[model samples]
Target: RRDTGVWDGRLGWGRLTHGRAADVLKNPAYAGAYAFGRAASSRKVRPDGTVVACVNRRPRDQWTVLIPDHHEGYVSWQQYLQIEAKLAANRTSTGARPPREGPPLCQGVIYCGSCGFPMSTGYRRADGTADYVCNRARSDAVTTPGCHSIAAAAVDAQVTRLLLAALTPEQVHLALAAADDLHHRHHRSHRGAELAVERARYEADRAERTFTQVEPENRLVARSLERRWEEKLAALAQAEAALADLAAARPVLPEPDRLHALAQDLPRLWDAPTTGAKDRKRLLRTLIADVTVRHVDHSRAHIGIRWHTGATDEVVCDRRTNRNPTQAVELVRSLLDTRSDAEIAGHLNALGLRTGKCRPFTVASIRHIRQQHAIGSKRNDPTGPGEITVPQAARILGVHEAAIYPWLRNGEMPARQDRHRRWCITWNPQTEDYWHNRVATSSHLKRTNPNYETGQAV
Candidate 1:
């Protein structure tokens, strides 16, 4: 009989063998375990070679099992290729272009004629129109007085027109002729001076030689004469060397064609590029003599531009809405004054004047003004005698030394010093009297009552 019913219990299977199971399952662990059997039908024969049939039992059912073990995971070759492609793309993007170089000219070059300030540059309204603005005129803090802000475009246009007018054929010829004439005259005068100096030196050398010959026995006198002659000769050599150097350094006048080309192309060159193109400071110093900006109202200005030709020819342009010639001339005169830096600064400050940037007058600003004016002695120790030592004077004054230092250093204080290291502190006699009285009172208190406090002493 065959057992074909489903089995619910655990079941397992192993290799089956008919002839010697021990020989087929050599391992002891597999031999001891019973091999699960499957249901099957067996055929049996009759008395004369007949087959016999029998039913077999089914194998026992087994529960599903899970094994915990380490295994390697696989990635698609295509995904690896994509990752490499991304890395390469990133590197190519990063290596595209170089950084821009620094600007050729910076804000130090741009100047506002109206306010005498450096103009700042910026882009306008996200469009390509670049603008330069004066912060002083635009700021709320500048309520005292000044011109309104000017558009860079308008200023550039005005500058272009002015340049065109100034560099005209007639103007160019005049400038060239004037420059040539001045150069020649200067050369002649310089040569004459050189000859005079040489003649003077020769006469002095001859005189010294004559003196040495007459006083041959006088060793001291003879040595002095020889030294004088040597000094004179050295001076003459130095003068000649200097003259040679100056001649070598003299600028060769530009040819007519070069001047004409410059005149024609200057406007375009100035306009096409940004304001920071080339050495603008040197350019301005070379070309412009002075720029005078006069305010007609809050928003308008009249500019008078002067060139550096020997002749006094100037171009006047209305940069603002109104035109005022008289005011312009006054402004020009103020711009071209020959005064000490301090004097000029004080005058400007007193008049409530400000620089182009609308900042208060400073010592540096005054210095630049002085340099422009070419005023005062260039020699070291230009100060006259009798100036007081500032800190010492300040100590005596019972004030901060800085306050008095500026006064003394700038020649504001009339006090003088003597060889005894004593300061003859002098000022207006009336002011001196007040100080003297104060000193006297302080001294009296100090002497009579040693412990008395200053200002509290009776």
Candidate 2:
């Protein structure tokens, strides 16, 4: 289709149909090749014993007569073969799907580990996520009804991390080198355009001088000289326009420091909004042959990756937990009396825990989880006789209450939260001395009370 002449309404030709398009693509004559025996007719006997004539298309290799470069063609034979290959790959029945424009990274190369069959991709309407599923029973009658279905987010995240790890800084540097080479080539082209402009200017100047020196009395010769001069001036103008266009089209390359930073932070480039799923998939297919996924349990899965270099890798990934798993809810409930919502959220995040929605825990989310489970908030229960609240402790230590919070967080000061989510510290003499010395020696701590003494404030 590349070199084929365009059709116009004036020719009174009908529009191209799908069948006609396929026929043209499959024809070797369009690719400047000649062939014979493209199809063969044969007789087949039906179950009723009646003979039926059938025609079957033959493979290119099976053709009896074939010749390349037979005549001018719309496309080269190599381009035609590539198109055929692309068409073949696009067919789903071929067991090889081409890279699609979807967000699933392993759409074409993911397989079910249990049944060893190609997995199909499905999107969840609720979250718009691509999931890999293998309907083994539907595909094969002999297989069991149960099959594997895993969310693409977890698997794609793992595979993307691995792919980014494989692209070392060395590879990034090589890419930078390629970019520099491309810039050099662009610069050379711009220089060539400038040289062309310069040459044209020189020719025009010479033509103008020749025309000026011609005798006015020789009208015929002068007229010819003037026309030649005008042509040279037009050529000069055209060359100058081309040079201006080239200058405007030139791209601005990144600075060397930015390039170095990009090499160090290649993931930023990979995660850029401009980078699409198809690009990421292509990069993955370059190194990874195929990925086989098997769910081990409700919260875990086993991922097997076969690289193009024949090496293989296996890793276990924990699946996203339910929104309010019993374990997580129980943990939150247990920590409720001793910790506030913010503290609980921080603890969960430190433990690498996520909410049922596969999101990191926040204070609001933790509070929501508590409310959903009917867990009571911290109460204002009375403290023991020897224990005092945070303000009392701060007054005893001769420092602002805000100054004591960091010590409690880092466990530098021994304390506990009351039922009201307020810090309760024991006010013994030894404890007082310890905090007094801590505040005295701590440069980050400020003693705002000018009238209070330092030793226990008693």
> Highest lDDT among the candidates is held by which one?
2
Top model number, TM-score: 2
lDDT by residue (280-317, candidate 1, tens digit) is 43454465554444456555565555567543333333
Q: Note the Cα lDDT for every prediction shown.
A: 0.52, 0.82
Give the C-alpha miss distance for residue 255 in model 1, angstroms. 2.1
Candidate 1: where are CA atoms >4 Å away? 1-117, 137-142, 204-208, 211-216, 234-238, 245-249, 261-276, 279-285, 289-301, 309-458
Q: Give model 1's clash tally.
A: 17
Residue 333, model 1: lDDT of 38
- Model 2 per-residue lDDT tens digits across residues 366-418: 87887877888556544677888876777677788788898889988777875
lDDT of 1: 0.52
For every candidate, C-alpha RMSD to the true structure in Å: 43.4, 23.8
